[model samples]
Target chain A: MQQIINFIIRNKNFLLFLLLFLLALVFTIQSHSYHKSKFVNSANFVSGGVYNSVNNISEYLHLKSQNQLLTEENNRLRNLLFNSNVNADSTFIDTTKFGLAYKFYSASIIKNSYTTKDNILLINKGEKDSIKQDYGVISSKGVIGIIDKTSNRFATVISILNTTNKISAQLKKSNHFGTLTWNGQNPATVQLIDIPVNAKVTVGDTIITSGRSSIFPKNIGIGVVKDFEKDVAENFYEINISLFNDMTNLEHVYIIENVHKQEINNLLDE
Target chain B: MNSSLILNISRFIMLVLAQVIIFNNVNFYGYINPYIYILFIAFFPVRDNRLTLIFVSFLIGLTIDMFLDSGGMHAAASVFIAYMRPLLLRWSFGTLYEHQTIRFTTIDFGPKISYLILLTFAHHLVLFTLEFFSISKTILILQKTLFCGIFTVILSIILSIIFSRKTK
Candidate 1:
């Protein structure tokens, strides 16, 4: 009994080290996917607030450009209203929510980086502005990215040019949708794969979001196909798309909150 | 136990805050982040027991891993450096190793500079390799190692020169 006690005393520090290491290792291994997602969510909640305040300062600096964009959009909307024929019986105009079918909240870019294995953008909008994961983000030029995480006043976005970003996009002419991915070699170009070999994929065909995504509305402009080829697999086609928006020069952006997102999510769950 | 002990703790806190809040966010050329936090562990007083030193190093790495979401790569690396530091220090400085306090500022200039540079390089090599996890991309790994190490060594030397008590 005494010998066992002595041995324990002598090895106490070593045992303590082993214990701490085991705890860390267990946390690494048993970190449940659900639990890890929760942790990431909370982290986003906290960091988002800090980013929003910092971005608010910059938003003040770019008020002029933003006003110009709003004016241009107003002019375009007025042009459409005057040209369309009125159907008095029905209030529905049958286009992208008709009266600005989506809510647009302006936010400034606080921290943005394009050169990484996974490119993430930090913007100054959060839960306070009704922003949530899966909302599509865009600048005046075109689609930017999708929100990945949200805090009270800030959110992180998965840029369209990120290697990890895969959104459903389709050819403008045929209504065929394929998976759009980035190759990480270039920021201006994104790769579209899984177009059926049968797709009438000619070079320079306009590509747009299929609206198959609950996050993004149908037919938002993404880019035009620059090049395409069949892979050795013979099952799918690889396409290069040239983006309309310059990701590197982004400043002001809008966060889109989809009204029917929860209903769609519940359906998917079921 | 001493003023140096209090100063060291404060430095540790400052280094960790700087790493998490500032340096981690800086991407000068995209992927060339400077890890100046490890300097806290590298310059711990030489008088500590080898076992205690290793444990402290492990804790340092664990703290970083938790924040950076690096799984276990940093933990594995820091423990290895802690284990090897004593042997490396003795071999590099010979009789100077017997001293209780490390007076890096007054030390023989050539050996002191070489020691700091070598250990800093060694730590970075272990870290980036485990991060990429392959013999492939050897060229990229070499590029990261040399540039980051040179940057870190320059910073550490500047710090040690200003702070080292031996210079007085």
Candidate 2:
């Protein structure tokens, strides 16, 4: 017993290092897996508050560009509203009167990272704002990511650029679906796999969400097919897509809540 | 002792902020960002308690991880380097380290540069390996380590020179 105690005391530094290293490794594994250890994340108050303050100063410097983006989005929305055909004799119908499928709340991105293999974004909204995990986040230009974790006043989004993130996407014209993933090489581009060779895809064809998942709604723009090649086995076509949103410079985004998600999930479970 | 403690605390805060807010967003060539924060561990006083250095390294690394949302990759790498720093110092400084007469500011340019390069590369290698965490990404891991290591070493050298007190 005396020898053991002496040995432990002598090697305390190594023992402490081993203990801390193992703890850190546990955090790394938890984060890599689908289920993250929540306490170690950035959605908490201290880190989130720091990001919020920094974003405020940077956001001020970006007012001109942000205003320009908002104006363009507004113009596009106005065109869609005024250009739609409505019969004069038909009674006006309110879409939200019956039930809304998805609810949208606007939020700003405080921190966005795309240079790493696993990227995450911090948004200004959280549980207090009704934001929750698995909610879909999108910019006006395209899909951004899915909310992964939320605190009282902040949330962390698993970006589409993350190698671990996979979204159900389809070719806009032909409705052929595949999995959208990132190669971790380029921030502006992502890859789609499992697209069949017979899908009749071409460069510049639009890609959109397939609505197969409960998070994002149908028909949200993702990107355009940039290039493609058949796998060696000739079974599937691997495609690269150029994103519409310059993810590196994002500011404003919308968090989407699927109202019927629980019902749909229950039905599928049966 | 008091002034050194204050200096280290301020350095910890400044490096964490500079890393997440400034360097994390630099995105040179769309993918490479220098991990300048490694300098915190690099410039830490050599005579401090090894256990405290290890703990401080883990704390700073975890703080950066929290802001960047990168889990504990930084913490693991920082701890590993802090543990190995004694050996690295011996290897780089030879007689100076053995005699406990080394001062970073007064070190020869060759040893100083080599030490920074070696430390940066080691940290980057461990960080990228744990981050990618797959055998298939060997090429990618090496690519990132090389590019990021070079950038980090360059920045660390420049910062050291700028911050170092006059030797004379």
Candidate 3:
């Protein structure tokens, strides 16, 4: 017993290092998996508050360009409104009002990272604002990412650029769909896999969310196909897509809440 | 002793902030942001209490992890480097480290630069490996380590020189 105590006392530093290193490894593993609440994240008050104030200054600097983007979006929406013909009749049934599947809330990005393999974004909205994990986040132009975790006043987004992020996306020209993933090589491009060779694919073809999942609505623009090649086995085509949203320069975004997600998930479990 | 303690505390805060707010956002060529926060572990005063250095290194790393939402990759790498620091110091400085009379500010440029470069590369290599966590990403991991290591070494040397001059 005396020798054991002395041994421990002598190697205390090594033991401490081994303990701390193992704890760190546990935290790393915990964070890599989905559906596990991470003990360490950026959604807490201190870091979130700092990022918020810094974002305020950056938001001011970006106002001019932000206004231009807003103006363009407004023009596009106005065009859609003007071009669609509306017939006023008491007997006409409005199908659009009956099926409001998604709700959107405006939020600004406080911190955005695209260079890392598993990038995450910190946004200004959180549980206090009714935001929750699994909520889909998007910009005026296109899809951004899904909410991964939420604190009281802030939330972290798993950016689509992250390697772990895989979204259901499909070609605009056909119903054929595949999984969207980032290659960790370029922030400007992501890869679409599991797309069958039978699908009519061509360069510049648009890809959008399939809405097969509860996270995002259907037809939300993702990117345009840049190039494609068949895999070594020739089973599926690995296609590269260039995103519409210049991810590095994003400021304002909208969070989407699927109103029937709970019902859908319950049904699936049965 | 108290003043140095205060200096270390402030240095920890400043380095963490500078890393997350300024350096993390740099995105040079979209991949080469230097992890200068390793500077804290690199320049911490040498003492017999290796345990203290390990604890401080873990704390600083965890703090950065919280800000970046990178889990514990930073903390793991920081602790690993902190544990390996003594060996690295002896290897770089040889008899100077043996005498226990070496001061970072007074150290010759050759050993100092080599130590900084080696430490930064070691830290970055561990960090990227944990981050990628795949054998397929070996090339990516090495590429990130080399690019980020060079940038970090240059920045660490410049910052140390500037601060050392202030102390003198």
Candidate 4:
């Protein structure tokens, strides 16, 4: 017993380091997975407030550009409104009832991270804003990410740039679908993997969300294919895509809620 | 003694704010991220308890990780470097490290630079490796470690030199 006690005393530093290192490893593993860990969620809960305050200041600094983008989006929406048939949806008295297919909620990114391997974005909207996990988020230019977790006043989006983030994307021309994933090499580009070799792929072909999962709607813009190559097995093609959105510089975004998602999922279950 | 405690607390807050608010946004060419926060672990009082240093370093890393949404990569890296600080100091300064504080102005130029460079490199190595967590990006990992390590080392040295008053 004395020898054992002395041994522990002798190696206390090493033991302490080992213990702390293991704890950190646990945290790393937890955060890497799709499920939100309590530690990370709470961390976001606290830091989200600080990020929102900081973003308030930075948001003011870029007001001119932000206003320009908003103006352009407004013009586009107005043009669509003028062209579309107002009589077609007489049952919909409220403008919010654009369609039963999807509902859009505007939210601004409070904190965005692009340099990390598994980048996550914090937005000002949260549970109170009717934001829920697995909802799709997009900016005016293209798809941004999926909501991973939500607090009372803030939420975190697992940015599409994350290595662990894989969405079903397809070529807009050929409809050949593949898994879109980031290579952790470039923020502006992503890789579409597992595409069959039989599919004809070309540079500059547009990619969009497949909507196989209820997370996002069909035809949301992803990017244009920059390059392509076959995988080691030669059975699949890996295509490089240059994203449309300048992910490093983003502000306003729309959170998409698929109204018929539960119905579609229920049908699948049956 | 009370003043020193207050000083350390303020330094902790200041460094974390600088790292999260300023340096994090400064993504130079999307590769080099200067981590001057390790300077806290480097400049910790020599006579302080190692356990306390480890805890503090872990907290510092966790704060950065939370802000950056990087899980625990920063926390693990910070703890790893904090644990290695004493051993590396002994290697660089031999017995001199035993009785003296590691303030940049007080330490000799040769050992100071060596210590700073080695620890910074080690911290970045662990951080990028854990961040990547795969052998496929070995080349990419090395590239980031080299560039980011050098950048952090240079920044840390400049800050140390600028802020460090020569011990009277």
Which candidate number has the best TM-score?
3
- Residue B44 lDDT (model 4): 85
Model 2 per-residue lDDT tens digits across residues B1-168: 999899889989988888888888778888888999889998888888989989999998899888888889999999999888988899999999999888776789999898888889999999999999999999999999999888888888888887785424
lDDT of 3 at A157: 96
lDDT of each: 0.70, 0.90, 0.92, 0.86
Cα lDDT of candidate 4 equals 0.86
Reference-based lDDT, residue A120, model 2: 92
Cα lDDT for residue A28, model 3?
88
Cα displacement (angstroms), candidate 2, residue B106, comes to 3.6
For this target, which candidate reaches the highest DockQ against the unseen true structure?
Answer: 3
Candidate 2, B-chain TM: 0.96
Candidate 1 displacement at residue B168 in angstroms: 4.5
Better of 2 and 3 by TM-score: 3
Candidate 4 local lDDT, B1-168, one digit each (tens): 788799789999999989888887878987578999999998888787888899899999988877777778889999999999888999989878776645545778788889999899999999989888889889989999999988899999889887785433
Question: What pairs collide in candidate 4?
Answer: none
Report the C-alpha displacement of residue A75, candidate 1, in angstroms: 8.2
Tell me the DockQ of each model, to 2 decimals: 0.25, 0.74, 0.80, 0.62
The C-alpha stretches of model 3 lying farther than 4 A from their native spots are A87-99
Better of 3 and 4 by TM-score: 3
Assess every candidate by TM-score: 0.72, 0.95, 0.96, 0.92
Q: What does chain B score (TM) in every candidate?
A: 0.85, 0.96, 0.98, 0.94
